[model samples]
Target: MKSPQDWPEPIVRVQSLSDSGISTIPNKYVKPPIERPSLSNSFNNDINIPTIDFLGLFTSDGNNYANKSIIYEQISEACRNWGFFQVVNHGVPPELMDEAREVWREFFHHPMDVKQTYANTPKTYEGYGSRLGVEKGAILDWSDYYFLHYLPCSLKVHNKWPAFPLSLRKVIEEYSKQVVKFCGRLMKILSSNLGLKEDVLQNAFGGDRDIGACLRVNFYPKCPQPDLTLGLSPHSDPGGMTILLPDQHVAGLQVRRDGHWITVKPASHAFIVNIGDQIQVLSNAIYKSVEHRVIVNSAEERVSLAFFYNPKSDLLIEPVKELVTKQNPPLYPPRTFDEYRLYMRTKGPQGKSQLGESDKSQDEK
Candidate 1:
């Protein structure tokens, strides 16, 4: 395997090709027939990932106990059954969400040179990035993205963030502040649901201030041959959890459910949440991170923000002590977020391939 710093081929922005008015995507972007999006014969139109209302769910003290309890049960069920859900009245101003998204769209429209000024290297993958993984000749995704770190203060460098679109940096800062707060609260709720101390998950994630957080702004350019390629390939997220601010105008995210793929319809002003691998390890398989992907379109382009709430890269994440037992011992070996994520860093995504080895113990029995 090549070093992660060495990208096997020259980097090309998908937006440039989309804007060039090319009728055919390059061969590198095309997946084999079996992995193509249109090849899936089962697309469920009537179903969607669950939607939960966050309004008044955590307002007053215990006065709303019954209602809050009902919501806890709903979230618990959502995590176990689908590993994904949409939240409305999530407290982030809808106006802020709109502005945050628009600024990134504006940034992407800037001249290629301006955007390229901050092009990223595989080492940190912290700026304008067109692809994931470093494998030579790997089939590429039909998208480009801007990635930046937000937590642990040291990695939060304002200079590295976009300077154009004047409002871009500020909106990104404010947007991240709100979403990070929301993720912290959700962590507590999840811990309580697992019958562990409310702070268990947070502590495991390196406490309140030291946890790792980052944003990946995805731009899925319009594809002429949308059927032959995908905006993103099928894979489970590698972090703790992901909060997505989707383009409400289009439906592209597909969730794998019991042998069928369900296209998710974005609820206006709501955020989509999905479980990630680290959480599955911490939850001792009480919840499994489901495989999902994004699809591009022939008519319009797309932009979405994926906010990843992850654990401290160096700390070991494993099945919590309470969840392990003689009959139900740890299903996954303890692995630090850094070590567990090396597979994707070099080889890209391959449908739970990173965790498949760790999952072997469970499969054996």
Candidate 2:
């Protein structure tokens, strides 16, 4: 019953929330489960989402390395068991993260004409403004974002980058370099956990093929109505890995865990790493790409930078043959990134399912 002008800047409330700002999540929007999610017998408490701390990397004591392994085990468990986890203390420098945030803000603040010059062209899927889901979707979510696909550097036009702020490009370039390095490190860790050589995952990602990476800057304005809209709809990442650097003070990011929506508490100088679908296939189902969404706050504008590391569009994604056996058969067939991306667009914004080549390919020897 609240009008857009009455409630808040970003959140548009069609239905009102209870006094405590809690309300029933409409079933129409809940993510469909692979199988029905079971409910608990107890109706007395709220669910708790697990948080993975990334700070253990710095401890000089034996516990640092010990905790590091423990965290890795927990992360592997979360990936195979829960599909996602939050990470802090990741080696990416906090100052770099800070500067990356500044660059995104500066880019988006450019005059509309300048920003639009890099606007998504007919076939290109990079650059400023409300992306794919915003303009044509059936639902209206309260968020604005810019996407930059960084790999295959020739694919990127450094000139397309904004010239304001004088140092914006330099900052973004540095941040991009750091993120790519972080991605390599994560692949090594994940590969080790999967009982494979440390370089297994990295080789799968960029082996004889280019890697695909993109940076997205999302802005969720203060909404007048907080109950009726979503900042980002519930969905899983369609790439290899995602590294998110959220705003320090504002908390609106949440992931679906167990059977409920768990709010992700933002930490200063930390990055949240998530495994995406392609990694799931590469790991032979040892890892998972979980579903997540963002909530909009009515109080202040929320900003987040999500750097997506993807496999090159042409690389064929399949389970490493070594991972499959009679006991551990392959769950998916070989498919190219182009095939998967086309599947994603056809399914529209909220579509699930990692579409591979075809069912016929699943029968290959």
Candidate 1 clashes between residue pairs 3 or more apart in a chain or in different chains: none
Q: Candidate 2 on 1-365: residue-level lDDT in tens?
A: 11111111232222222123444443333333331212211122444345677675545778578778888887788778766666766778889888888777766666566665765532455655453432332444556677766787767777766676689778888898888887787777788888899887777777524788878788776655556556776567788899888888887776665445667776568778788878888888778677767777667777789998888877888997779999999888888766666555434345235543322231221
User: Candidate 1 residues 206-322, lDDT tens each?
Assistant: 999889999999999999999999998888898999999999898799888776678999999999999999999999989878888899999999999999999998899999999
What is each predicted model's overall lDDT from 0 to 1? 0.89, 0.66
TM-scores of the models, in the given order?
A: 0.96, 0.79
Candidate 1 lDDT (Cα, whole model)? Answer: 0.89
Cα lDDT of candidate 2 equals 0.66
Clashes of each: 0, 12
